[model samples]
Target: MIYITGDTHGPKSIGFNSVDGVLHRFNSNNFPEQKNMTKNDYVIILGDFGCIWNVDNESSSEKNVLDWLDDKSFTTLFIDGNHENFDRLYNYPEKQWHNGKVHEIRNSVLHLMRGYVFNIDNKNIFAFGGASSHDIKDGILHPKNDLKLIKRWKHDYTKQFRILNYTYWELELPTKYEMDRGINSLKCNDFDVDFILSHSPSSSTIDILGNNNYKHDILTDYLENIKNTTKYKYWFCGHMHINKKISDKEIILYEQIIRIN
Candidate 1:
């Protein structure tokens, strides 16, 4: 069986599992259905598996998360989300996993790259993950001097001045190259897949959902094109912290977990 869920912000406890320190929501005893799952089964995270943050030198938190995931009954797979530490995630060696290329974070944890299709349990799945963080608003503003001035005005003149910066990166959006790669890969497969998994909903999908808070960008435009052109049974995504079915084919997951296949 293949199960999919929404963003899990690392080891921080959430929902009914609030008392479990440093344990992912998936690791909680509340989800007893997972206990019956075997290694052959898969639990794919929508994105923001923040356990990989500050992975340099392997802190105790990172180790604990890794060990817990590795000990799970099923393999864990995820794609990069806006909150991920790209530097640490990119350091892992690329290898093939379940008919797609991935950065193996552990024996059972895999980071699925953008623009790839995998054959899992006799089903073809297209995975692409990334999104712009709305909280940062207008990412890294221009006029560096003005930012420094603002910092100076907020504090003593003798204090060290700091420049304002964005918490989210521009790399959170897909590049032209990545879009082309995904299109070409789909073309190679005749643009057919059973599932489309992404971190953010397509621009049109967001509009249909009436989520005015999210601004459309080049990445969302590309996904819009894919939505119009691609052939897939279902498109699952996570970013907006809400659970809704935009259409018969599109689903936005936050905390809800469901079996796909």
Candidate 2:
């Protein structure tokens, strides 16, 4: 069985109402269906799997949340999102799984790399993860190698501008190489896959969703190209932070977990 859902910006002890800490979707009270699931069953988070955050190191608290998820019966697999700490995420050792490259986070936890097609349970699933963050207002500030900026926030700061490699990472968008690799990977697959897991929807999809707040960027444009060419059954995404069926085929998920046939 394969299930899909949205951004869990890390688990939170705050409460069930907080979107930032809404990992309870997998809990027995919320998703009792998982009790019957086995390790072979997969629960895929579209993006913004934020448990991998924390700049300096993998904090003990973060480890506890990850470890808790690992204890679940179903395997946990996530893709990188705009909220992730890319510096720490990319440092994980890379290996191949299900015909695609991945960062094995734990025995049953895996970080699916962008632009790879995996043969999961006899189904071809193309996974691409990334999107420009909508939270940036004043623009992203580059404080490369600046010790003072890392240690403390400015007293008179606007707080609108996200600090690069700190609050925000430019790596949230795919590089030219990553985009090309996606194209090449799809080409090798003959441009057909059972599904696509993405952080951002295609540019046309944004219009369909009536999301005018975000603009078209390199990542969305790239996704637009894929949308036009790829022969995919369903495209599942998470950036919009809403649960809606954009069409019969394209779906944007937030909290709802649905099993895919």
Candidate 3:
């Protein structure tokens, strides 16, 4: 079985801070369907799997949450989103799974790398995860010399501000190499895949959603190109925080867990 859903940022509360990670959606009470699942089954989060978001050392809450997830019967696969701590996520040991590269976060949890195709559960899946943060209207703050920006921002409640290397990472967008790799991978697959998974939707899909607030950059343009060229059955994305079907072949997911195959 294969299931797909949106972001589950982190635990509800890390220490004393309240969060919006929405980890509870996977619990037995909310997603009781997992009771019959096994390691052979897969639960894929589109992106923003923010359990790995702490800028510093892994907190106890994160550890507990990861362990709790590991205890689940099904395996978990995810990709990075803008909210991820790239410093931590990119450092995990790498491994090959289902013929694709991954960051081994745990025995059952894997971070699917960008620009790769994996044959899992008898299905071809093209995975690419990333998105620019749309709410940073105040712009990204630099940590060049001011180390206390986080404290100051928290105290002052700065509007729509994100700190570099701490809250915001330039890697939230795809690199040129990643784009090339994706194009090469698609060429290898003859430009066809059973599924396309990403953190952000194609620019066309954004237009379909009729939302101008979403920014268009290299990543979205790359995705738009893929959307134009690739022969895919369904494209699933997660950044919108809304659950809707943009078209017959594209979906933007959030919160709800849907059994896909």
Query: Least lDDT summed over 10 consecutive residues: which range in candidate 3?
Result: 13-22
lDDT of candidate 3? 0.86
- Looking at candidate 1, the ten consecutive residues that score lowest on lDDT are 159-168
**lDDT of candidates 1 onward, in order:** 0.79, 0.86, 0.86
In model 2, pairs of residues that clash are: none
Query: What local lDDT does model 1 show for residue 168?
Result: 41
For model 3, state the Cα shift of residue 202 in Å: 0.8
**Candidate 2 structure quality by residue, lDDT tens digits, 149-236:** 5446555465555787887987899988998899999999999999999988889988776766788888888999999998988999
Candidate 2, position 225, lDDT = 91
Tens-digit per-residue lDDT, 1-261, candidate 3: 999999777767344433245467687887899999999999999999988878887888888888888888999999788889988888999998897899998899889999999998999999999998998887788877655665576666556788888889888988889889989999899999999999988887877788878967888889999989999999999988899988898888988799877
Give me the candidate number with maximum TM-score.
Answer: 3
Best candidate, lDDT-wise?
3
Worst 10 residues of 2 by lDDT: 13-22
Candidate 1 Cα outliers beyond 4 Å, as residue runs: 14-24, 55-57, 138-167
